[model samples]
Target: EFLFSSLVETSTAAELAEKLRADVSPYWAVHYRFGKSAANLSATALAASSLDALLINVAAPLRYAYLRQQGTEDYRERSIEFLCGIKPENNRLVRAFGKSLQPVDASESQALIQLYREYCERRKCFFCRWGYRFLSLSAR
Candidate 1:
């Protein structure tokens, strides 16, 4: 948390964020929207789980299921390579969680990819209440 505060208060958040991402790692302190996870990602408990992508799916919470980490077979799905647009006020996840951006395992990215693969095979997302909520809403 202190790391983020110092970065924010330094008037150089953008610079630091870029530096971190250049390493091909998501910033642990933000709420980035990589895509969405196929498994449950809304409980807050799993919000920062090692297998959890730092990104959140606001428009479609079930989009969480669609998010991919760097090492996942579908990791390419989560790549923000083609993004270009007028972003919303809170596009990145960092602003949402920086205040308590605890230190995550440096190995989180790999672990998350594995978990995502397992989650996909089981197709347990259909059982996720949050997933059901997103699915139901899409029909409307």
Candidate 2:
């Protein structure tokens, strides 16, 4: 867990899965047969599985606990991209932003997703770039 957390803190999303698998393999090999098969796992599958496990088993409970004690402020910077109930398009859009924006970190990605949900999904066009342009043109 510590190694996984360290990788999360230091590695990019692309690097996290392979790093986690490499780092955990020895321990896994000693304890479970599944660990032996992990070597054949694709990076995409590993990342998705690891993310699901972390979010469901670790992050959700921790967020709930923190919310109970101190409220949302404590988790304001945390990423909710993979959490249940979020639309998959939000995650895909964030990835697209990363490609176009070139270096969108977790917090920035979260902010972009929030902006998309609040403005794009809700059709708050005047507040968004394309919307503002459209509104201005219509006004003209």
Candidate 3:
């Protein structure tokens, strides 16, 4: 059982991600952000992978190592897998923000906040539904 589990764990998720990159690597491009990875899918061009075992927490949204790679205008409706953290919290904020959150489609619903409020100020002004409502008003 140990050997089997080890074999399964050996396959990193990045390998599948790399394969996804190869099929559409050279022809694609991203427009915003500051540096190289900001415009490219990632470093190392991805690596080979196979999945023999999987582990997940279905109760929470997923996370990605390079979370900033997720952009608003890229796709219309999508859900992310293989992401590594707390995503449902983001989803809650977006839901409260309504349309001012533009690119309000399902694809980008679980994005983390770009700017965070001060910890001393209380998460009330930071992570609350009211905060999202406030941001939505200004974004318009």
Task: List clash counts for every candidate, in order.
Answer: 14, 0, 2
Model 2 misplaced regions, further than 4 Å:
1-45, 48-61, 64-90, 95-103, 129-140
Q: List the residue pairs that clash in candidate 3.
A: 63-83, 63-84
Which model scores highest in lDDT?
Answer: 2
TM-scores, each model vs. reference: 0.19, 0.39, 0.21
Off by over 4 Å in 1: 1-115
Worst 10 residues of 3 by lDDT: 50-59
Candidates' lDDT values, in order? 0.32, 0.49, 0.35
Weakest 10 consecutive residues of candidate 1 by summed lDDT = 80-89
Candidate 1 residue 131 C-alpha distance from true site, Å:
2.4
* Predictions: Cα RMSD each: 19.1, 8.6, 16.1
Residue 139 accuracy (lDDT) in model 3? 88
Candidate 3: count the clashes. Answer: 2
- Give per-residue CA lDDT, model 2, range 1-140, as digits (tens): 57635433532333433444544444454454543554553333344555645544455445545554555563433434323222223357556444444323344445567666878789797888855875898898
